[model samples]
Target: MGDHFFRKLWQGTAPLVLWASHFFFCYLYAASGCRRETWAVLLGATLLALAGAGWLAWKAWRGGGEASLGVLHMARLGGAILALAAIAWSAMPLLVFGRCG
Candidate 1:
């Protein structure tokens, strides 16, 4: 039971965690003085985060057919979707300004 709980919890939170990490990296990079490579690095991070969140959403969507787990699956899926949106939103400044302000 404990293992199952943990697994579900991870599935629900992994994408958010990835987003947080990406957000932290973005701020850290900006603080480090927007170097010439800042745009490229930020783009890479954004793409990676998108891929991770998308994958997590896909996994949640394809979750096991156990009826008892339906709610958990939905929760995971919702979290992944939220993470994807947040990750994209956070990258918007990069898209618009193309560099640190």
Candidate 2:
């Protein structure tokens, strides 16, 4: 059950963890230069994070679906939602601001 511990943890919140990392890098890049390329990078990052969230949702539903993991399945779903919200929040600046002044 030792290795299974990490597996369960990842299955539980990988999407949300990835979202946190993505948010950090996106914000770091934007704050560094706010260049046009930064938005492109951010777009790519957001897409990747969203895709990860989708994968988490699909994984949780692959077998008996939510019935399989019960509370864990619900937690994964919650993580997916949070990931999407974080992605959206991180992306907003691209629409609202320009390169650093």
Candidate 3:
């Protein structure tokens, strides 16, 4: 039961988890009044999340079965791309918000 649960969990959820975490942090930082230090923290966190997403994408691309065209593999790739886009969207505010309020 334990192994089966874990196997299903790891099938293709890395990007989703990372995206949620990134969203939470970005929201927290923004709601903090966008302090001077928020820029540093936000940039750092975004970069770190981007790196993680990139890693997951690489793994998804390489870990497929002998069969090159599979639904699960394509889904993982799509998820990774969506995650990257979400991270970029969240990072955009850093440039839009002129300064601390």
Candidate 4:
């Protein structure tokens, strides 16, 4: 029971956590100094976050089963989707500005 609870907790929160971490890293990196490598770092972080969120969403979608688990999986799916959107949105400034301003 404890393991199951923890697993569910991870599934529901992991994507958001990844998104938040990526957001933090981007700002921190940009603030440190907009070096020539800044774009590369941001791009890498964005791709990694997107991949993580996508994988979580896929897992949530594929893990669906029993009625009781449906809600939990749905929550996981929703969180993953939200994270995906947030991460993409957060990366937009990099694309639009094309450099630290």
Candidate 5:
């Protein structure tokens, strides 16, 4: 927590946000019960899940894989990326249709 007191918070929250977004959107789409080539959306979700795991593994490898700290570090980073992507993807509807202010 020396140099990363707030840094880790940012890193950790990203994945949490992404995970939340994934579920939110997926459910939103599913609830509509409409069918129109869902592969793209499904693929995005799959990639995000895989990215989180990959990030953890990357940290483990970078840290020699002897300590659990590395694994955790990688996981947070992965979540951060996924979260960011989720946020971006979620915004598409807003951008296309414009949101009310």
Candidate 6:
């Protein structure tokens, strides 16, 4: 019983952790009010985070067959795409607000 419960919990949470980081990182940058430098930083950090997540998924895949790297990897890639989009979206405010002016 406990085994099944823990297994399910872990299964559910593993991807959430990977995805949540991207979400949180974006949220942090967004809430700070957009700026050109910050936008670049956010984009760079997001790419690095995505790369790290990819590495983790690859490691998990190569480690054992029981690991669900597919779900984790998909979640990571989706999160990264979303983060990139969000960062780009946030950049609009900076650009419109006359950072270029």
Best by TM-score: 4
Candidate 1 structure quality by residue, lDDT tens digits, 1-101:
99988987887788889989999998898778977888999899999999999999888777757843677777788888999999999999888898643
lDDT of 4 by residue, 1-101 (tens): 99999987887788889999999999998889978888888999999899999999888787777743677777888999999999999999889989644
- Evaluate all candidate structures by whole-model CA lDDT and list the values in order: 0.86, 0.76, 0.82, 0.88, 0.57, 0.56
Error of 5 at 4 (Å): 4.8
Give the TM-score (vs. native) of candidate 1.
0.88
Q: List the residue pairs that clash in candidate 1.
A: none
Q: lDDT of candidate 4?
A: 0.88
For candidate 5, lDDT tens digit of each residue in 8-99?
A: 66555656765675668666865665455454565576466557645643553465445446645666655655555654565465346432
Q: Which residue runs of candidate 5 sit more than 4 Å off their true CA positions? A: 1-4, 60-101
Model 3 spans with C-alpha error above 4 angstroms: 98-101
lDDT score for residue 15 of model 3: 90
Return the candidate ranking by lDDT, descending.
Answer: 4, 1, 3, 2, 5, 6
Better by lDDT, candidate 6 or 4? 4
Pick the lDDT winner: 4
- TM-score to native of every candidate shown: 0.88, 0.80, 0.83, 0.89, 0.45, 0.49
Number of clashing pairs per prediction, in order: 0, 0, 0, 0, 1, 0
lDDT, candidate 6, residue 74? Answer: 50
- Report the poorest 10 consecutive residues by lDDT, candidate 5: 92-101
- For model 6, state the Cα shift of residue 13 in Å: 4.0
Better of 2 and 4 by lDDT: 4
Better of 4 and 5 by TM-score: 4
Model 6 weakest lDDT span, ten residues long: 92-101
TM-score of structure candidate 3:
0.83
lDDT of 6 by residue, 30-73 (tens): 67875657666656666666665555555444544554456654
lDDT of 3 by residue, 8-79 (tens): 466567797898999998898778776678788888899999999988888888877774477667767778
